[model samples]
Target chain A: MSKKNYIRPLDIKHGRIDMGHGAGGRSAAQLTEELFLAAFDNPFLRQGDDGASFPIPVGARMVMATDGHVVSPLFFPGGDVGALSVHGTVNDVAMLGATPLYLSASFILEEGFALSELKRIVDSMAAAAREAGVPIITGDTKVVERGKGDGVFISTTGVGVVAEGVHISGRNARAGDVLLLSGTIGDHGVAVMSKRASLEFETTMESDTAALHTLVAAMLAAAPGGVRVLRDPTRGGLATTLNEIAGQSGVGMVLEEAAIPVAPQVEAACELLGLDPLYVANEGKLVAICSPESAAAVLAAMQAHPLGAQAVQIGVVTEDAHHFVQMNTSFGGRRVVDWLSGEQLPRIC
Target chain B: MSKKNYIRPLDIKHGRIDMGHGAGGRSAAQLTEELFLAAFDNPFLRQGDDGASFPIPVGARMVMATDGHVVSPLFFPGGDVGALSVHGTVNDVAMLGATPLYLSASFILEEGFALSELKRIVDSMAAAAREAGVPIITGDTKVVERGKGDGVFISTTGVGVVAEGVHISGRNARAGDVLLLSGTIGDHGVAVMSKRASLEFETTMESDTAALHTLVAAMLAAAPGGVRVLRDPTRGGLATTLNEIAGQSGVGMVLEEAAIPVAPQVEAACELLGLDPLYVANEGKLVAICSPESAAAVLAAMQAHPLGAQAVQIGVVTEDAHHFVQMNTSFGGRRVVDWLSGEQLPRIC
Candidate 1:
């Protein structure tokens, strides 16, 4: 196509990338304007400032969180690194009951990384941020030598506001508190690993990567003062995050293995790989510890959200001096759900 | 020496490394107890929560920033990736005029990354943090396969409290704003380049790697409301950062080329490498845009601080139709300074 012919809105499907896309020139501006801004249409980002500026809401405190994404093969079967990065950090800040407002991304690109791929990832990140009602206002870019790094790595930082009279922490888990899972377990991990291992599941399972800030708001509205702890299972996954809470709060937990929600495809993939679904990662899921008196209310709130349709109460806290987590197997026997001993899967997030 | 005898702390140096140090059982605890905790003695870190929580002062906002370091040849003449990682994020948060309080470091290590080298970087980072009065409170560790990643990459996240009544931003610059620079430029860029290229200079230069939040605090104390913007000249260097401020504030600036500071040795190294000091990066320097009314006061305040003893007034902003940042050369010529056409020396940060 002639240059003028290509000046229209980007043809997302038929377009390949060139160096000018990352050149910080007119092409870069066009990419941001046509693809990214279109995907992430938010008021704060519309201002287009080098960095965002805003005030914390009255009677509220601000929370900030950041996460880095360097997943290989930028585009994955389930979700790209861009969407994963947005969801990862947004969930991190939301776990504290904060309303996310703005995000900043820093991209480290390898010399040969395709600009088309970067634009796609950037657009995906922008889409996720917009859907979550958050904005990507500021960003930085740097390129490493071709052999020195992966294709691209993105680090995103987000700022959020937390209303007053709300306090949540990993150490707040108390005995008798209920453990809640936002959705099905191991979907994200299984999806990404399936692509990596060149194996096919019985069904095509997309990774459940999403921002949980809105759901967190709903949960807070339901159980304002009863939410104990909130954490998203990332690297070492469900088993590791829960163990951390158990160790931090000095309390054990009992989980019903069968009651925990895991998709059949994820189960099959785990079985094929000889991996435990319980120990696999979940991007869009969260573990909520709530007071027994408010557990039902919180669950109801979660169920009302589209992202939390499969939310379930899978366990309850227990009193244990050693803070050992135990789970009731489907065979009606109790087994120790200890901290992850060694690496299960790397970079599953 | 026997196997047990070889485990002596100081004697177990300059070796390929074994598993004892990162096991997180006994030897890991020993490294923490004997070296790190001793060097970085702080109440919050001593208590050792998953994260340190403190009382956020009333009427103050908190700022948080995180950065990941994946530089090659981990060690160089003047500093290593360890010190740069800590100082980099702290400076980012401090550029907002916040008082840095705590830092969290997440380490991604290759399975065979030398334990001794790992210990050295940690110690350097710990010492740098302690010296700057910031505590290393919480951290995470992961090991990736050697071929999958570099030797080590350190991701540091920092949290700080912004004092009340202090609002600093790149957009805060206005017409008649004077630009003041602290210390010599290009030292860091030249130092890293020299070591990387094995180049020689009349005088060996050192990387200007130091925490600048204290200087920021001092500048605020001197002219709190007068300081409009503070920026560190990092990856894109001064020329690009100044252009950013100009674009953000919709003002133009004229830099006096001779008034800007550059060490002779650094200038020579840049010349040897075909790099310009104006576009070269700096770690320990900052760009301050303030009202002309308080320029002297801010300059005086910076000069009093050890970190800013060489601070100088470099330029003044003006109302320009083009909103261009130009430099008046020592030889009496003028030219427009633009945002880096591309990153100047990628990954120099």
Candidate 2:
């Protein structure tokens, strides 16, 4: 790169991506040095190898998670694809009861995509990583021909370390365990949907896209080994995620519709669009299952965090041979909450 | 998933990916279980969590590498995107002198992509991972609208561990170090190009796509702590990679053109297509820099490996303030081996 110092600087303001940007040549190097490396600067990335090498804490189990973000309208109400990419993977690792340590991002950019937009996304991603205390250590970038790709798609992979005796898995849930929700559902899905449909409401609906590692840490601190399972209801929303947990743990769940929190604006938007709030996605919220003895403490700890201010007990695990998730409606009727049947929305996250 | 066992199995023979497959619904779950899980079956993945948690070797530094595959033709002469995706990231981690342990794959599929083709790719990916002794422990799948994506794009992230006292970096290249080539160059790029152009020859051209971790292990065993730098010349081929190392190490290099190996068919194809072999990518080959004292043993070890049978001494590190890489041509003239200037080929790997 030093030898090519005489080359022209990238025109980030007016330039558009082309085939040369992904050709693995001088142009690609220049883009990396000027855009990605500049934004994701860290000691590990500065090593400038094909990968990043770092020391891990001794005797800790490692957690790995990956996500592909293809949210349309790269810029959304409260978050863009950039921050969503980071938060989505970070939340996944956090849901495994681990502290995220590093991340690797791969970008698939379409030819003719705006460099300015790409820069904005990278900057947002870097900010999100910094806030989450994880660095983007290594990444790869590729460009597809025009019409072959929709602007850009990002895939982020996260690595984290779990402390000793942290046994968290979907199968860990037990009968009589208490189910807790960190916050309202459907904010992320409704926010993105509103943006896509050009729908406007009296009050704006912003995405609840955020990193929940700290909230998980707080819950873990409150009840070290009592928490059974942790999961974020991203796609298929809360209903599908609960069904998955039920099947995994070989237990049924009973949910009280009145207990599950939902913002009035999001509920209204969903009603207008004929979308069920139960099947809507939430980027920052999580469902945690714990013993009855620890549920109070975990819920309190969650409510103390800014991201989990609306935390509440939403349901309970039940013993059922069929592993069905049943919901008691506020109208005094019970119904089976099955997995999301069809496409409620596409590219919601 | 057990509760949803009554759902129809994915029609692997004559189905196309639809919006529901990525909508985080029953269709998505069904596809994941019937296709991805069945093909890349493993205990870690079977945990059925948002992420995979595993214990790492105590007191070893971890290495992470990522690559995105968007090759034009999904199926190439010697490999498809699946095998290429695995070998690419595995080799990147190997170049760091690390033993790869686990992998995570993310797929972006276009709506209307053939399920049969996707199954083939997934099977190939699973085979490659199994052969390389690494498991795809966690993954994500996203589907874009038809015409929004070109068939499919895959991004694979690899995690590895390096033993203590093994310090390998591009900046470690010192003046007077011996440069070694693992085998012939341009096989991967030329093979893919020939397939894309519908060109044929008396001898078929096959991509040299194979995991190099075992070969790297052999070289390390023979020359422990003697290897200075290791790199796979992928995109931009040998010339561009060498120039990158030169800039990073603040040194120059001198190469013997005649010593570098190129297959007869590959050379003929390059000549006929007006392409430079030095700028064509090679997926299975590697370039190693080591002290003169250890070059002989290291070269012998590489040659003993099936992947590096044509190993030879191709160049030597030189001290030059300009950091220029020059080669002595067979015609008795010296030429500067500059970086790849433009897009010679797009989506080659």
Candidate 3:
């Protein structure tokens, strides 16, 4: 047909979302066709159905995970909500030693949201997924009245495939397993806090929100059966993640505080904010628990990757009745690291 | 360790959710272990990993869909948020003629919500998934500060498997195809509106929230290739769904208004509210397009299923330049059935 035949192209440059854009009517279609479809253009999504259908790899196992992103500021220094949502779920699937395949995004947009901003976020998400070699095959959009929601909330669900005989789980950690850290911590949390609170610091802080599937794939290849568990310290940070693993495996963790890596700027920011780096979130880093025999191989593989060049062996697992995570401080004191008690910084990821 | 060593049990009967519950600390772990885990217990979830990994069906194609449910009142006469979230995603998967396999639920909870109510919603969601023979394999939870969100917003994503040869899509519709209605329309939308607005009539209305996978499987088995497209008439309701299919298929539709089924109570409720039943959402109903040669067999199968007992032939595909959805009124007049322009009812799910 002709250009005029279709609803006049959305005024994406300066248009504000209205109820009609989410009413599942003509306006919603225009928004989707003109924006989302144009950005996330893939064969599966073009089928025009409630869901997307694609053939799964014949013999590989399917892995699925979902995460809800409610970051305070939609945009941050290093990344925005779009890239964060993509990286967050992709890393979750990779934690299983699985190859990330497809993603489905569901957005809860508040009425009056600017179309231009939405386009920017969607474009960034599409780019992240593409760079990770995963396609956003399907998605859903809903708009809520203003004030009922923050600017936008994105929940990304990803599916991946794991080859046969690959077993990765928090419950697989054993007493002799050594824990490895991918890189410095607390950059993501501090970045978000700085942006949200408008705290100006001498040094610039950026979110470490990068996809880690490649780094994981390389590590898995290096020591496939030796790796016991893999986890990305996000909300409750390294301490909470270690605690979960210890409890799941019925073991204990002993960490050397001096061995753990934290950027100087991040450390100074945390010191100023009275925050604990171990408890601050890190979007790009990971913790790998593997047999002591293969710890060196895994660490070597991690050190070779750009995202994990700062990799180090931070701790070791031990048999303990209490499954506690204790840190031997640089000050010659040891303290038990426990789960977070209450909200520290809300909507960090 | 004894039970006393763990944090005190949550007060399910009278306690309210605080920042601690979502802080990813002791309280968060306790709440997850005592509440969400207790309700959604399964071998996969017990693994305690960032994501769940399961074996994929050998040769079946994977189908995935995600939906954001922000319905109001949390609870309605026929169903609550938990059940609605499950049914909505299940139906979306089934619309692809796939056998629903797994689901992932992500919740964005607002602080200060009641624990008892949250438990009720979780229980209902679990029951719905169990009834449909699908397990929720993985999930994520985040809490926003009070007043930052509605009571709760759920985003459910489902993954299903379709046999190799099965192909169903909105783009498959063709001229001379027959359209089928699974059951009565407007029940779900009206029921929610009634509860939200506190409007009561002589006869009560209830949401038609249900999982339609089994019914869809039966229809696909009986009419395989004959089936062109299967769509759930949700959000923008029947009219919007039909328009979407028409646009996708590059065809038009002619509907007999008298043949479309709407319960008397629902019709009355819509009339009282100055609403059009055609634009009212239905959770338990669907619209199917099939080859005219196989429409009879498909209709017969639908009529036999409990969920599709009220099935009827409501329209037919036609050739038109504009792909307009025009309906013949019961009074022998015809009018264009266009897409929904504005929000008829927001958060109607």
lDDT of 1 at B344: 47
B12-129, model 3: which lDDT tens digit per residue? Answer: 9998888766667677778777888889889888777888988777546779999999898899989998999999999999999888889999998989899999999999999998
Candidate 2 chain A, poorest ten consecutive residues by summed lDDT: A1-10
Candidate 2 residue lDDT tens string, B270-318:
9988899999998999999998899999999999999989999999999
Candidate 2 Cα lDDT to native: 0.94
- Model 1 docking category: incorrect
lDDT of 2 by residue, A1-349 (tens): 5677636889999999999999998999999999999998999898989999999655468899999999988998999999999999999999999999999999999999999999999999999999999999999999999999999999999999898878899999899999999999999999999999999899999999999999999999999898999999999999999999999999999999999999999999999999999999999999999999999999999999999999999999999899999999999999999999879989988
Cα deviation at B12, candidate 3, in Å, is 1.4
Instruction: Quote the positional error of residue A42 for candidate 1 in Å.
Output: 5.9
Report the Cα interface RMSD of each model, rounded to 1 decimal. Answer: 6.8, 1.1, 2.2
Q: What are the models' TM-scores?
A: 0.85, 0.99, 0.98
Q: Model 3 over residues A70-146: C-alpha lDDT tens digits?
A: 98899999999999999999999999888888999999888889989989999999999899999999998888888
Q: Which candidate achieves the best lDDT against the true structure?
A: 2
What is the Å distance of residue B316 in model 1 from its true position? 2.8
Candidate 2 CAPRI grade = high
Q: Write the number of the candidate with greater TM-score, choosing between 1 and 2.
A: 2
Off by over 4 Å in 1: A1-51, A57-62, A161-165, B1-68, B101-111, B136-144, B155-167
Off by over 4 Å in 3: A1-6, B1-4
Clashing pairs in 3: A340-B25
